[model samples]
Target: MLVDQNDQALRIGPIHRSVAAVTLSDLSELSEQRGDSFEVLTDRERALSCWTDPDDDMAAFAVSDGQAWAVLRTKRTHEVDATVLHESLLPAWHVADQQVGYHHSLDQALNATSRQPGLVVAVRPPTLAQVMDAAARGLRMPRKSTSFSPKPRMGVVMRDLRDA
Candidate 1:
């Protein structure tokens, strides 16, 4: 939640409030088709701000302000290729500890022997003081440390549960 220094909050959700049941058949065929390690994140489903340019269909998204920007097409599933997932495009932010229970899982499955896979750290950035404190303790931040907003834009438009 990148907020204004004055403490203004950004709107963040239109969460789908319904639930549905899925059948085994629905998962069967879909499970067989293995998508790449990286998957496309859909905007229609998430509470994200999107600006469409009148000049062209090109769009810009701040994955994390001052850290990453993504140019996407005006399509349903704007599939960004695997190449963009490389560190050059979206560098790591807050990743320190590497060894974990899942280390072997990635090593064996991906045939990767990296002790530190340099993966994305789904965490928020620490304050300047916090960063200094960690540095003093010889600790490092996680890769691409960022605050993940579960519900991005909310409260702008409201719906009454009961009719007037």
Candidate 2:
């Protein structure tokens, strides 16, 4: 796959808005029009999620929940509805055997940049349908667009695939 001139990692996201808001078909067409290549990640066993920005200094979403709210509340200059946010905004993303809808990831990315600072830190979750569809079509999301959780670290679940 081809890489960008920036030498900056993409960090992964779900959309490049089209007439349909955020759909794979439109993205594909747009990419073709722009002369961009698609790079799919072929791991069916892992779901993905990660935050990325065009520049290294631009970390949009917060690693922690409080950090996210702090950034949003400070920027919007309003008393954010914590109750509504708690109940709706921060709900656990849906994943099946590890799958969170692309829509959810895109929503976070878009909602994040809807205001004054149009810059965003895209956080994408590997929705099974989208990932599989891309793979089936021989297409792929650009590298760094998605990240798997429980990243390799001490005390996290570890597995050995040698037997399988």
Over 109-147, each residue of candidate 1 has an lDDT whose tens digit, in order, gives 122222222221111123445445656988544333322
Q: Residue by residue across 1-164, what tens digits does model 2's lDDT show?
A: 22343674333333321011223333344435544332232321111222222222222222211112111111111121222122222231111212122233434544444422222222323454555676798864543344444234566665576768
Predicted model with the maximum TM-score: 2
- Which sections of candidate 2 miss by over 4 Å? 1-118, 121-126, 150-164
State the weakest 10-residue window (summed lDDT) of model 1: 13-22
- Model 1 residue runs over 4 Å out of place are 1-5, 17-21, 33-76, 79-164
lDDT (Cα atoms) of all candidates against the true structure: 0.26, 0.31
C-alpha positional error of residue 87 in candidate 1 after TM-score superposition, expressed in Å = 28
